[model samples]
Target: MENIQHRNINVNGINMHVAEIGEGPVVLFVHGFPELWYTWRHQMLFIASKGYRAIAPDLRGFGDTEAPPSPTSYTAFHIVGDLVCLLDSLGLDKVYLVGHDWGAIISWYLCLFRPDRIKALVNLSVVYNPRNPSVKPVDYMRHVYGDDFYICRFQEIGWEEEFAKVDTKKLLASFYFKRIPNPPLLSKDFAKMFNPPPYTIPSWYTQEDLDYCASKYRSTGFKGPFNYYRCFDLNWELCAAWTGSKIMVPVKFVVGDIDATYNFPTIKEYINRGGFKESVPYLEEVVVMEGVGHFINQEKPIEINNHIYDFITKF
Candidate 1:
């Protein structure tokens, strides 16, 4: 495995810190919320050794990337633009794209907006939810279940400030703790993992990982990333215009079966039952890892790397 070389490139009026390794057909990794380029370390090394140039960049609001002042700038449009600029900066006309969590969402939007630029796409842990042309996340929550959902509350003002004030180490530990294995039917321990307030800690995450994540947050704070939630309406408005657009490129999706994000009844039962063909016309495969969780890459790096290598080799 080759060591990753860190580089910065001026792209889209921002200086982006990019980590690249190996040299062949390009593979770009986009990290999700609460993660950075470091999340792809195992994959980067493995893919590089396999004769593919593996690259990861700190997304706009996370890690070493600049944290702009305006919350409005964190929208998907900006994120997509940053990525497009990154590809241009690297002189890649097309490349394989792999993303997890929020990164998955951005990759979905990218495939919709610019299919020509993506050779293939592999998504982990996040599914594409087509935009409701008439309503946003807040409106969807209101109409279905009132405003009791913690995610809805996260959209409110001062929410970031409150979350930012907490101990960063605890926050990272709690975030990682929720993904551990549970009984056949999510047990009390698993249920407690998703509790809102304190975000109860799990024992699996190492102190070193927690400390590293906390240090990054200490420097960047959470405002820029938190602002992503605040731009639901604008993102929806932009997405509405692309409703009928399909991801025409080759695509694959992988997720952890026990991931809390898909704990909703319909999600588990009907996820593979595809009725929305127009949204993802080229989806090639879907993989569900049994005991993993939201941090799919970290929790199951070998499986993730194998899937990525298998997919990218076809290109």
Candidate 2:
């Protein structure tokens, strides 16, 4: 960790924080929900040691980056725009792109909106979900998964307040250690999920790590992060021009076999069959590690790092 260098740079009309190390061909790492650039700590160090410049930035609403108050500011275009300006600020034109969960979603948009800026991509967890065109994302999620589904429940106006009420460290622990292999259901009585006694930290996560994330949330609150979900529909509406677009960039995807996202109803079929390939025309590889859960990179750091290095080296 001491080898990593941290800095804040101006990008897309806000101050952005980034962690970087080593020096060679650049590899940009983007993190997911409930995570900051710190989540990629292991991979950054490992990849940097392997002679590649590894850069991880806290997306607009996460970590030390300035979080715009309006949910409308968290759109795909806004997030991708921040990254484009970030690369330009750093004097980089194209780099290897890697992202996980929401980061993966945004990477898909980045490749779609600016493939010229990406040499190759290694995306984890979430697959590229093609727009339906007929229904907005939130409405589609509600119709398919019902109101209790976590994403649907997150759409409510004051949900972040409810999240704030819980103890920050404990709330983060619950999210990090969760192992349910099905779609998450968060009822109106969602507080109960955090109320279970005797919570244990997973082997992959430390108390210090939880505290680090908690301290950031304590200062910023969860509103900025939650706004990412809130902008789903608006993102859908704003991306109409990209309706039938294919990701075109060279790509590799990885997911944990037991990860809740991989188990989503038809996700397996979508990934294994022609659908994923149809959209990601340049996909190069797919790996499903057994016994792993949602936080694949942190849960299985060495293997994840190797996967990333192997793919990026080819380019």
TM-score on alpha carbons, each prediction:
0.88, 0.98
Candidate 2: pairs in clash: none
Off by over 4 Å in 2: none
Q: Which lDDT tens digits does candidate 1 get at residues 1-315?
A: 336798888878888889999899899899987888878888898888888898899998888888788878888889999999999877899989999888898888888888899999999877777776666776876565456454465566666656665577766666676654332121223323434465543443455666777898878877777777678777888677777566788888898878866664356555657843446787778888887888888878889999988886777
TM-score of candidate 1 against the unseen true structure: 0.88
Model 2 Cα lDDT, one tens digit per residue, 167-265: 988788777888879788887967656685567887888888888999998888888888899999999999999999999999999999989899988
The candidate 1 region of ten consecutive residues with least summed lDDT is 182-191
Return the clash pairs for model 1, or none. Answer: none
